[model samples]
Target: MNLRMKIATGAIALVSAGLMTFLGTWEGNGQNVVYADNLARGLPTVCKGVTKHTSPVPVVVGEYWSDARCAEVEKLVVQKGQLTLADCLTNQQISQNTFDALSSHAHNVGTANTCASRAVGLINAGRIADGCRALAWAPDGKPVWAYVTDAQGRKVFVPGLYNRRRAEAEMCLK
Candidate 1:
């Protein structure tokens, strides 16, 4: 079946491997314990970037999760993110690469924000390349979703996030 059909029928049974690879490359292997996400205002995260906001399991600071547990949580999180992306992109046909790229972006920045962003809007409007570009930068030349609050409460651009977004954008173009 085609991407649109699978999305429309909710028949995409599993998260795409590309998304798993993307998350692994960006979020790193499950830390095996919760650590403060410095980029997210010190949000406690574990297991391939699973945080309180995103994890199916409860997340506690300093809590340990074995590799098996981390893999479970990561799978669940990625599946959930895929559902969110599918919902947001309803009726829109996209490549698996595009879906994986957007899923990773949504997983990082929050699905709600991603769904409402110019990227989604552009994609829904059939401007696939424009949407991909929006993942890296806004039309105003500002980095999109690449800033994090520093300890001093100043917004600082994170090169890692910028690079990730650029990579995701490039993936979508492939």
Candidate 2:
């Protein structure tokens, strides 16, 4: 592989079916409904977790869309997210599964934060397995980032986030 081969020019599937399906399964593929995202302080979300920040167009709480429209917007959101993820990643070739897993991770954590995370740094240092492990665990082998701040500012572990991170880490390792 060329040394400069990045996701844009490499064989990394930017919007592969596998990624779409994985996102749909985890993000909830509602046909045509917009609702508040409890995980995000009740941000308005629609069509497989498309939020105002991620959507190309404006997202309203009660906005309605057709099934095709939902898919289209979701695709656009995913492409934008994957492209941002590619930009954040090092200019080295990676497996489609790893790229997809990282893209999903980035989608959840925001690209800027994900780019600055220990996982990305480990991957850039060529410790791929360690990078994957860092997605869910700290260097001391304790789980991390699986919590939500409650209204009282208490850290509450979200089982769903834990499961999702574990799955993403497994996919990255593969």
Predicted structure 2, TM vs. truth: 0.92
Clashes of 1: 0
* RMSD to the hidden true structure, all candidates: 2.3, 1.9
Q: TM-score, each model?
A: 0.90, 0.92
lDDT (0 to 1) per candidate:
0.83, 0.81
Q: For model 2, how big is the CA root-mean-square deviation?
A: 1.9
Number of the top-ranking candidate, with TM-score as the measure? 2
> Best candidate per lDDT, number?
1
lDDT of 2 by residue, 43-101 (tens): 89887778899988888888897889898888888888877777767737467888888
Pairs clashing within candidate 2: none
Q: Which residue runs of candidate 2 sit more than 4 Å off their true CA positions? A: 1-10
